[model samples]
Target: MSTTPHPPRHEPEPGAPRDLVGVGIGPFNLSLAALAHPIPGLDTVFYEQRPRFDWHPGLLIDGTRLQVPFLADLVTLADPTSPWTFLNYLKTRDRLFPFYFAERFHIQRAEYDAYCRWVSENLPRLRFRHRVDAVRWNPGRNLFEVDHTRLGPDGEARATGRTHTRAVVLGIGTEPHVPDPLRPLVDAPDVPALHAADYLTHRDTLLAAGHVTVVGSGQSGAEVLLDLLRHRPPGRERLHWIGRTPAFAPMEYSKLGLEHFTPDYTRYFHALPEPVRDRLLAAQWQLHKGIGADTLAAVHDELYRRTLHGGWPDAHLVPGVRVRTAGRNGGRIELHLEHVQQGTRSRLTTDAVVLATGYRQRPLDRILADLDPHLRRDSRGRPRIDARHRLVLDPAISATGCAVHVQNAETHTHGVGAPDLGLAAWRSASILNTLTGREVYRLPGRTAFTTFGLDQLHPHPHPCPQTPPARHPRELTPLADGT
Candidate 1:
């Protein structure tokens, strides 16, 4: 690994170029960095716009636990022996024994965030507070040129530099999404409407309000509502929770249902017809979007506790309702809502609104505009990602041995596991294996017992032994010499 300090611009040595230039320092890319750290000859660097690592800071409420098990950490799933594992972090903090005695399968969200921070701080190759401005293919040098601006304490641009590398992996992550109907209220400076992403910052003010409404059915919404309910008085607990789904559903936690997040299922989903993939994603929202069973129970218990006082608390839980429009009343917010089932309209006035509407994939078109002509697209204009997670590009770029890889942005192509924490280590290993042209982490041949398709079981009978077996365009294949 190499570090270029304070130079006006970074210039790669005549014979040495970075093996990979990671564009974002989120958990996925951080996993790649940790795995690549011990490799003898692989040179890599990661950049992040923030000065430090923090995952969903505002949503890391007290007692909120991660959906995945602790084993799904940065390096555990792919390489349990790595020093960057969560167990190692606990040992360094002198809490290993306590953790073992706790008998906890799932850790708290704040602890997970802190574990990632420890990894980021110890990793030498990470360049934080540097915003990547542009990425372009340099035909003459046969490499990708990455431009970035170094930021100071106040986030001002202190300097600018460039790095040339053989490959690029984008782990830009996602941003909180606010629905269109309620955008105006959130945009208004005087209004207290905000997204759940900023819940912690405004929690006190929200709790003090006359009425608070949470608008989503996911885990975040449940957590926020539960927190508010616990702090308010019994009879005066004026809270409303609404969502578009018919009922507050528990996530699919059955043993077989989790196979959807395995490597085999990812491969199967990638090979299906594009339209079929689209429809399946729309229908399988509960797989990754529903609230966890434990969280649902907690919410119920909190509400149930409030009812033991002899009178029902001033709380309303409604589903199958959508916010049509929102405006400001004298000192409160007015929301126009529609019932999806009855097609009836109603209005509700609240002091504040929390839009827990979830997040969308951050678009890559802006940063990849220079490479637009070389990118291959699907019918819906989405980038066509191959089984190896590399964006399918035109022959002109592919032939040059440079690939553009994406992380946490392939739900459309890789199924519901795209943004899952459990798949982070495996995905990073796969990308590293492809970049180094060798079996870096030695991934499992089969991760699930369920056969995704019958054709996979019986590729061909004795009818035509000599004929070649059919292969999907997106099927993963080992690259020769990691070129």
Candidate 2:
């Protein structure tokens, strides 16, 4: 709502490369953009394929709220005094007093989306409708070359251009993840199966169906099922909610349990062996992937209300179930499901299926395909991401000091905090610090009460000196005098 005029679109000057060029303008890169806006001489630009910023548009259901608190906005966690904080947004709309009185910690998802859009509109150097085609290192110029296609309002390519930058940040975000067994049905035009990412768009159709089955038990699944339950009649609500977990469990929201998302935990997780890190990520799903307790309560409350003076609500809430296969049976859909715990199989014929199986990190190989040879990879064929969130590249590229940072795509390397919104600002600040070679926003050295490793307990043991000995290089040789 500020009266500042929109800055003109950026065009890279010939023979001059920018300090950084960000690809994909999702919340992560948007956070980077907001944090970078105040730097005195930092030259940065962010691009997105969409016309404007819209975070999970289809999942922004009414009454649905973010799991994280409002203070975990794009800039507040890293820089509360910044003009672009969420509080300032309310002030711009003249609703600051109302928001202050509301005393709401978790804001609605729609409001969060709107807040991001507001930042997207006001921030300079964001070029929407620009699709980055490829990225490659120009050995001759010692810079990264980015190729992009400019799309018109209709989404057709209108022109193509290239830009040069000393560093790059990839924030393309995630895509709707449909399970392998249900992929065919979701891909077919006639099938009713759709991922929860498009839940709002097809809510009306789902409600009109005779029977609807919601798959997966994450936060999205709970929200969608609750929405459908609220709309359907008490006895006629033929809804089924099933998932792979043992129960529709609540997320770990306890005070100390929440510390896993802190910078301290991220550093600890990063320092562990690669195999251990991989095993830990697979076992820590409940930390960030479970349903919120409030949402679970709402679901329970709705079901209990329906049973006031009648039989049950014709709803089946089952966990430990997985969809083995799915197909179209005339106008209906048939889902072959298995109970992981009971080892039982059943065929469910329903009018619709919503796969809230959650989202996977969109692979970056396509965008960085041209630079594949230069990127270092793990045994699993994944790129090796460093503690600073930059992709580990070959020695030749590293020698140039040109970095390729990733946003929301480092779960395998940084633990559950990688994709979390609560850590978005901190991660962005960290990246900017490395990119600018200066502390633009001062960050805390430690952010948790719990010491993560054994070394913290025996800092100076009986066998070791009270004062720590000076550190030496890993390959340091003994002195010539052998003293």
Candidate 3:
């Protein structure tokens, strides 16, 4: 037998048990990372394909706001009294004054993204650029066999490595889906067809042309169309925005509508049979599924402003119309349309087509491909998952002692709440409890506040020993004035 010594284990501490390996680093997984790190005896590591935090950067329109309220940040739902909460972030940044001045629960998408990065930076628990390729069950040891492909700091692929995890959480995010008609234009040279994800990156290239055509009626489509129309680079006619829907419907927003995003709704939806739940979600969450109210206002303002200019460049809402076909000819994309209501047809040739059709869930091929025969799949051919979010392994693989959990793939089972920040903290705590067979971090009011964030909300936060720094991290020393 070989006598090579292994590197130090990445466990929490000596004799600490291994818990979870989160497969993605989006806000959903990042929130889980934040909550899991504070747990004393659970060893958890989150893997991300990207080098750093990037949440829908292309969709980060200049004036777009968050869909959920600001209080629905990473840790609050799990621990309302947790220090790492968004409220605590506001306090640390000293923006609590400005934040309160706004008098709304929502925050700008940019600021929210920056806050996520700020929270991520202070926590040393996440592992970036580590993409999970596959997971297998080794039932003999009752642990998961994970194979990961990581990119080095220099942007080169490092050798694939192995890590053993008691449970695995798959948080692979969504992939952008564009219509078939526009697919040809995407690859053509100088054709300038793109998706909303590439909007900001390709703005200048698209703006160089005389006119632009933005398709789809969702938030991204509306935002890109308005931005192009309002901010014309030097000289240009108004941009053309086409829609399949009858009109641009602003997202539904109300106190009760907001509850549809809560964990309670999640449990309610999860209780229904698979097919019925899917139909209910599609009907109710349409507008709630897209942009927020503030963004609609900005788009309306721009449209109104252009109308007052008198010399309105040809822009048509063209309700009840859908694109029959799109072809690039003579340096222009010819869009043939069908008016569903009138039963008539028309065509528009434009410089470019910006598709905002949205995205689909990333596939589970590379990760679970090899073990295809040893795993159960749902009726729709997706992995059949358990309540704890673990993948039920086949008998052959079950003998190897492994269990795989999920982090992001839950639309069919858990509803849209699967990818939300609302459940991250609680989910992490649950996974930790399951893996370690004990409560790792005490929930607020579960016991008593003895740690950082929660304890501070008292007369003076925490053990009567700490106080808010005078200028927010300006002084490194402890405060004597603290109770």
The parts of candidate 3 lying over 4 Å away from their true place are 1-17, 233-236, 285-287, 309-313, 395-402, 433-483
lDDT of 1 by residue, 341-414 (tens): 99999999999999999999899988899988888999989999999999998887788879989999999999
| TM-score of each model, in listed order | 0.92, 0.93, 0.82
In model 1, what lDDT does residue 241 have? Answer: 99
Over 1-483, each residue of candidate 2 has an lDDT whose tens digit, in order, gives 553323534544655788899999999999999898877667888889999998998899999999899999999989998888999889888888998899999999999999999989989899999999999999999999999999999999999999999999999899989888989888899877889999999999999999999999999999999999999988899999999999999999999999999997998898888999999988898999899999999999999998899788999999999999989888899999999989999999999999998988999999999999988898899999998999999898888899999999999899999999999999999999999887788787557778887543323233434444432224435567875
RMSD of 1: 6.8
Candidate that would win on TM-score: 2
How many clashes show up in model 2? 0
State, as a TM-score between 0 and 1, how close model 3 is to the true structure. Answer: 0.82
lDDT of candidate 3 over 359-457, digit per residue (tens) = 877887778777677778877787776666667777665444446767767777777667666567766666555656665644332222222232223
> Once model 1 is optimally superposed onto the true structure by TM-score, how far is the C-alpha of residue 63 displaced, in angstroms?
0.3
RMSD of each: 6.8, 5.3, 12.3
Comparing 2 and 3 on lDDT, the stronger one: 2
Q: Positional deviation of 94 in candidate 3, in angstroms? A: 3.0
**What lDDT score belongs to each candidate, Candidate 1 first?**
0.89, 0.90, 0.70
Q: Candidate 1, which ten residues in sequence have the lowest lDDT sum?
A: 1-10
